[model samples]
Target: MPEVVFPLDSTRSFTDQSLVGHNRWHPDIPAQVHVRPGDSFRVHAREWFDGAIRNDDSADDIRDAPLNSVHVLSGPIAVEGARPGDLLIVDILDVGPIPQEDSGPLAGQGWGYTGIFATQNGGGFLTEQFPDAYKVVWDFSGQVATSRHVPHVSFPGLVHPGLMGTAPSADLLSRWNAREGALIATDPDRVPPLALPPQPDSAILGTLSGSEFDRVAAEAARTAPPRENGGNQDIKNLSKGTRVFYPVFVDGANLSLGDLHFSQGDGEITFCGAIEMGGFIDLHVDLIRGGMDTYGVAENAIFMPGTTDPRFEQWLAFSGTSVTLDGEQRYLDSHLSYQRACLHAIDYLTTFGWTPEQAYMILGAAPIEGRLSGVVDIPNSCATVYLPTSIFDVDIRPSAAGPVRIDPGQGVPRSSF
Candidate 1:
């Protein structure tokens, strides 16, 4: 076992930890721990919601989930000698659920959840169809996940951290706030507002107090969107053995991460999607001085994905165009096309007795593939979603026999505002 630099107690709240972490992104959030560039260490991360979300069969928690306090990252662990204009190399050595404990109220104790957020809370990619909140709890056995709510399916989890990033420089953080705040000002009262602005209501900056805490909280950027600093990118391929290069904007390169997922499909389509869990991540850090400018990687993270991602020889695929369900056409909108593809998959799954929510959960939590298959084809961008055929208990491939129906047990739990 590596040296556990930041340890977390499964039964305690994130704020009660020995070395507290922040929920928002701010360079001023002092580094609670320090590691040398060549150090190999362990970090215990709380699930995004801390332990507020439960492992039971209800979507009430999802509906009322605290949006303000999220992503609950584990560090601003400064790397010694890491400086501006450099690139920090992060190697994910290992990651998994809580060590040694299998059963507990906390997530990642052999179980985790996938949730579709309510439109009023945080609308998902398919929120137009799934307006209400829905929840599915999946049990982990070795590397696979099986759900009672979404039955007749089991698949290997592609466990990885859903959020990880280096701290933003003051100028970069100002730019983030300016752009995101401008977007929010357009629809300040919009339900599930355009973009989350910095709010001091639930800000958690490490070890800061007095007016400094309030000032920093008001100026910090929310961890909901991925920015130049790499917050909440949600890339599922960043699993074990992946090497990532992040541009450093501040001295010491304060890096933080959390929101581990047992598995997630491409895009994490559902808003609160992925099999969200609390876990430990083993990391090894190094530096590439001046590599940011040396490689023209000035913003965002670039990575060589791990070779150990789950493999499936055959897949059932569905594709969709940029045309809306109501027949409105949009030009070159890959995001809209992907949403339509996922909706098409949900509709097809309903033919086999799985509820739409169950199908959406599968797409969010399984190792499914999503691709932009036709972006250059004129007005209509085309996106395709591929599901591993083996994950389903019944034959899902198109055949002369048509689709085979399987019993969907108990269905996903639901709650609405």
Candidate 2:
């Protein structure tokens, strides 16, 4: 098919009657454009927080962005010849930060920002330890990310698109909201389990073709965590050359994406991530008839490059067990135990004179990886955090930090974002 280009112009209007500024992703949102199978496309997306931020901007600038408008995604590009039960293959080609024309000395190409969420908002992997909001502007030249706000450490870049997904059918959207709402109701502290709950987007509502399907779609769809529709699954392995398989639900598989990152480690410990920036993306999209049937799963699956790229370095690993060093079961849930492990890694890094904020930025900005070492252990499970040794010039290892503490209550509460 032909190559489609979704321009970066923030002022261009769509046939759907929505202005260019209407960039949020929701099933109710109408498709701005369409492409045929085997078609290649280029799209321009804004940073997760949009362009309100600058290199010199502070934590306040980070906090000022509304949670509802978290990821300013580009298009719900409808793919022709794609239908329900089919698989949409998105081949990532290239990703880079866009140059800023009005930028100051520190702003422009190779420059992007990272942020920690505010405690009052109550979200993130390390919410309790790094309660206060923080911001760090990183320089991405020389293929390494270095931040003055977070000094004494730098790492190479691994550019990737943080969000990629297809639009859900109206029925699927309702089920998602209902299931998520029920999960939130079960939390005693009411910590939000869902990444995003449905919120009204007047921009999307205005663009609906006034069809009954569009109205229902509007009330149920949300862009947050990864779902069958495939939204924000911050998997670091999905760099250039990666093949992403998204299950199709809607007629055209309305694929939309945004939330670009210069580099990001696993877990995205903080709510925000590495060097968020606006950039253009090139993708080759194709359809596989009955591929979903052969896979036997109705979700997103990623196929990694056959060979590890030279950019990835050897990792120094840190391990944490669900049971204490003394062997007492702390949490029955393996996922919770794994979280404690990550926190342990964070605390240990603080011994190197890095504040929690700095450490948080390090974990997010660098290509530090997280994995569950094992989950089969009945009472005690284990998790490991691996940091690429090449990221630092010095021999950075965990030293005698104070005894690490795990707080089960320290997590994001359930709320609409």
TM-score of each: 0.99, 0.84
Residue pairs that clash (backbone atoms under 3 angstroms), model 1: none
Candidate 1 local distance difference test against the native:
0.92
Residue 309 error for model 2, in Å? Answer: 4.6
Quantify all predictions' global Cα lDDT against the true fold: 0.92, 0.67
Tens-digit lDDT track of model 2 for 1-417? 224366664332232223342444445566777888887777877776556666764567666557665565677788988888898998887766664433333222568777777665545776656666677788877557777776657777777888888888877777887887776667735442434556655333324555653554357555667777668888776777888888888888988888888888887777776668777678989998877888875765556541223365577677777764455677556666666777676777666566666667778778887888777876767888887767655556544764333222222121222
Angstrom error of the Cα, residue 319, model 2: value is 1.2
lDDT of 2: 0.67
Task: Provide the lDDT at 127 for model 1.
Answer: 83
Best by TM-score: 1
Taking every candidate in turn, the Cα RMSD to the unseen true structure, in Å, is 0.8, 5.8
Query: Model 1, residue 178: what's the lDDT?
Result: 91
Model 1, span 110-202: residue lDDT tens = 899999999899899888888999999999999999999999999999999999999999999999889888988988999778999888999
